[model samples]
Target chain A: MKAWLRFSTSIVNKSVISDIMKLFDIDFNILKADITPRGGKMLVEIDGPQASESISYMEDKGIEVTPILKVVKKDTDKCLECGACVSLCPVEAISILDDWDIDIDNQKCIGCGFCISSCPTQAIALME
Target chain B: MKTIEEINQKIKNGDAVVVTAAEMTLIAKDKDIKTVAEEIDVVTTGTFGAMCSSGVFFNFGHSDPPIKMNKTYLNGVEAYSGLAAVDAYLGATQPNHDLDIGLDYGGAHVIEDLVRGKEINLMTEAYGTDCYPLKKIKAPITLENINQATMVNPRNCYQNYAAATNSTQETLYTYLGTLLPNYGNVTYSSAGELSPLLNDPYFQTIGIGTRIFLCGSAGYIIGEGTQHFTEAERHHGVPITPSGTLMLKGDLKKMDSDFVRGATMPSYGPTLFVGAGIPIPILNEDIALRTSISDEDIGCKIFDYGVPRRTRPVIKETNYQELKSGKIEINGREVPTSPLSSYKRAVKVAEELKKWIQKGEFLLSNPVDLLPNKGQLVKPLNIIKPPKMVCDIERKPVIITHPTDPVKEVAKKLVDNDINHLPVVDKNGKLKGIVTSWDIADAVARGKTKLEEVMTKKVIIAREDEPVDIIARRIDKNDISGLPIIDKDNKVKGMITAEDISRLIGKKNNK
Candidate 1:
């Protein structure tokens, strides 16, 4: 739970930190989110179900994931069968039309969302 | 059974608790609890925790940039506090701070003495204690970006003439010339420093080398070494037409080297323009607009409309009543009075008719081709074509004074008029020995008592037909004002001075 809290960089105020840390009675180290020019996204993973309630508690206190979620299409009927998106798709989720129909390899999709937004049509959806 | 008070007793004994404002309000029935909660609330918690899920959402609530953690100065002590304090002090003590700052920064010490005192000091103190409303967000500004604009001002050489002796107008021009090469925009006025009159805020930052061009009645101190150029547009309120006009070169090679494809001579008035056929001659419409009138209309308007404003009818003093009565004397015969109202009315009608005649004829005229030779619109006062061809004559008019005229009065007048020679003339207006500008100097040098006491009557004389160069050599050798251009009887045709040579040959190399 403390490790998950360390990944969420929302409380910049020292007073807020002391108050919230005292309320939960937990000692946690804080880190700044790695904000790239391309985007800034804070990721947290709970290893145990016991940490779920604490994660929910932190969420309730105004800690957020990536502020914006971009929805886009990767594979659709607009494909000219050039296979450019397929080759450029880092996760290999985009595939050429097998039988004149595009197939999205959903299991292979890393949910990085770049390919979805780069597609030329409203054919791919990034579920938030 | 344990009552609810027993559970509350347990909570008070240090059980885990989540106290909200509503529960705190119920506890706040006791003033002591209310005071305790108020003290504990160091910062206000946001009410829109769910709505403002992200910092971007907070930005959507207001267009201002997000208040990032790095923005805080020393644990939320905003940097604006110090800056605001300074701005407040400036505003209170100097309500006209924008204007005051310019004067102070310009080193205007007198203004400081006038504005600074005990009252301002007290106001500044009072202003400091007041709170200033914090702006939600202001765009970042850099000093370099702020100074990247041109400032314009009018300049009067007369007002600051004493101070300007050390100040160099040439330096101002040179600086502007340097900046022009770098494609920097600069501003100057034909009127005199305009920033104060225009209430320009950037006067202080405008720089010492800022070029100021005053073209008209800027009340110039005559000997202050101030000179202005003749602008292509006469709209600068001064009649300084270029002494020599721009001419197109006929030599094909020279033409190609001299001007670019789009190059054309700057035009003035209604004149015939000839150039390489590539870029044809343009009318006044081609120039910068303002008082731009058609080339055909310029001559008529200037000669007819503008001139008549000064010229008046020659109404003889004796005939004033007769002219007012609309009567006329024609060939020694008196005519019956017409029904005109007054002399003013007759003059007005005459002026109108003269304008009609001028407009009708003058508008159709064009300048004669002065090709191969650059033209000048010379005034008669500034030109003299001797009746006979004379070569190498001195350039200036020689002054001849009367030998009997009081030398003191003549010398004083000569000095006042800025002329050197005073040609001595008899009562009959015949020539005599010339008093050179240096003659007065010599009289002063020798400390002569009077004009008759010490006067130089000896002088070299030349005929009107003498080659100017020969006369020039004699004048130069003798170190005199010049030989008078006399007739066969030794009467003054005209007097030759060094200025005559300068007027002719000195300007030959110009343009």
Candidate 2:
């Protein structure tokens, strides 16, 4: 199971993620991360039968954990392919194809919502 | 040169070789302009962008009592009802006032609903008259129920537009999309080589009455659009400044929702995404050459939008090729670029236009009139205080005299009021001329005592609503110390002097 985790400045310095890893037999992979002295966000893929339990345990420790059902979903019917969302993506997930259609790689999207609000047409949405 | 009639005839016969501007560039690389012009009868061009000046006019068949709709709403969005009793014009950018949909739906959504064959809630309010007794009416309406539904756009398909970037330390949300703080990204809105106006840069083959593909339907160019600046600097007839726009009119019933979309920008309200395509008849070699223009040849200036002024300074002049490359160097930093206009949709529009022409469903029309090759210079709006003269008698009594009055009396009045200028008026109190002390002295030297003879006949008067800066400039240009302020009826209202302007400036500086 994959999820996006948000940590506040106080919790960011703490080893809550490592504590969760040790408490549960869960293998975690940091797909993407952005950590500042203030606070940060991370996209992690947690593997194990107790992935749900590990996420719950992290929530109990004051770490915000949101499970990722679909990272990003683009409404093609509403999309004008204006490329307004391409540059704001932290990862190079959104790109213009040869035909100039804006393509977003859901695999590379970290669900940052940077492209969502940046989109003038409001065609891109972050799906949890 | 081949005429549009000849090209249309070839199109009717399914013998006209038509290609999109993109396809024509490839053909032009292999063959000369003359050969390409001879082979191709028409070249299709297109643009898909957020055209804010778009609207749809709908003629809903009269109600039972035929109420004059003074106010209207379509799916909670207000539609302009100033046209006729039942006719209404729904602007693309009108926001949904009644619905708290987070500004997601608007007039464009109503248009899309109509295009998609969905019923829209039509509500109108009118003051009940004797003949039209109904005051308020609410009903569901569809495109089929309407007598006429046409998309009338004042401006579409700009030849070129500015690329936008933010220089400020904070992120800015503008019509150019989101501009990240500290020049994080640059955004431009144009289809580059695929744009319709770019392909017919000079308006040689496209003008009034020229048929076009508008949102998947056949439409016509009505005239040169609003803010159409044709004389902007050009490279190969392609404008570097935003110029050569087109006014388009088409039936909304025939349009597809896929091409015409309602777009809502965060905090900017609603705007229409219009897909426009114009097929240029290869009338001559020049037309062929113009159609073959590529992204490398078309260029525009990147403007810094952080200045928050109409006249923002240009950061750099860059071609469409560099813009399309997705990254540009701005202030020594590698800034990513995004296009607000969709080239894919533009290409799709062009291809669809070509198909329509090939199938004889569309025909090109010769221009009824040509757009002027030149445009007037655009001046920035000067911010100045509105002219408000002190009409109180304590400040300064306006020295005045009738035109038939003696020049000696005007001179006496000027001296008595301790003023340098006096306004000469007629019996009806209309300002006739202005007589200065120097003019009165000159007239006395010439042995003329009549006020009309002494007064300056060519007087540049300032209006009551005129800006102070413009009046000041007039005073400076004429080398005059004062000007007579007049009302709309030409009656002398008051007088403004250079001293008064300087006093106002001093006051402003103090603040």
- The native-contact fraction of candidate 1 is 0.00
Lowest lDDT 10-mer window, candidate 1 chain B?
B49-58
Q: What global local distance difference test value does model 2 have?
A: 0.84
Model 1: per-residue Cα lDDT over B1-511, one tens digit each: 2222332343344331222222223343444533433322110000100000000000111112222221211111122123222221011011122343321221111112112210111111112112432323333222122211111112121110000000111111110011111111111111111111111111111122211111110111111111222222222221211111121112111111111111000110000101111100012221111111111211100011111112322212122123222233433543222110111211222232223222331011112321111122333343375422353443445455666666578788788768766666676666766776677777778886456555566656666655566566567757776556767666666666677766656665583
Chain A of model 2 scored by TM-score? 0.63
Flag regions of model 2 displaced more than 4 Å: A4-16, A21-43, A46-69, B376-511
Pick the lDDT winner.
Answer: 2
Candidates in order have lDDT scores of 0.29, 0.84
**Which candidate tops DockQ?**
2
- Individual DockQ of the candidates? 0.00, 0.49
Per residue, candidate 2 scores C-alpha lDDT tens digits across B33-84 of 8999899998998888899899998899899977989989998899989877
Model 1 residue-pair collision total:
30
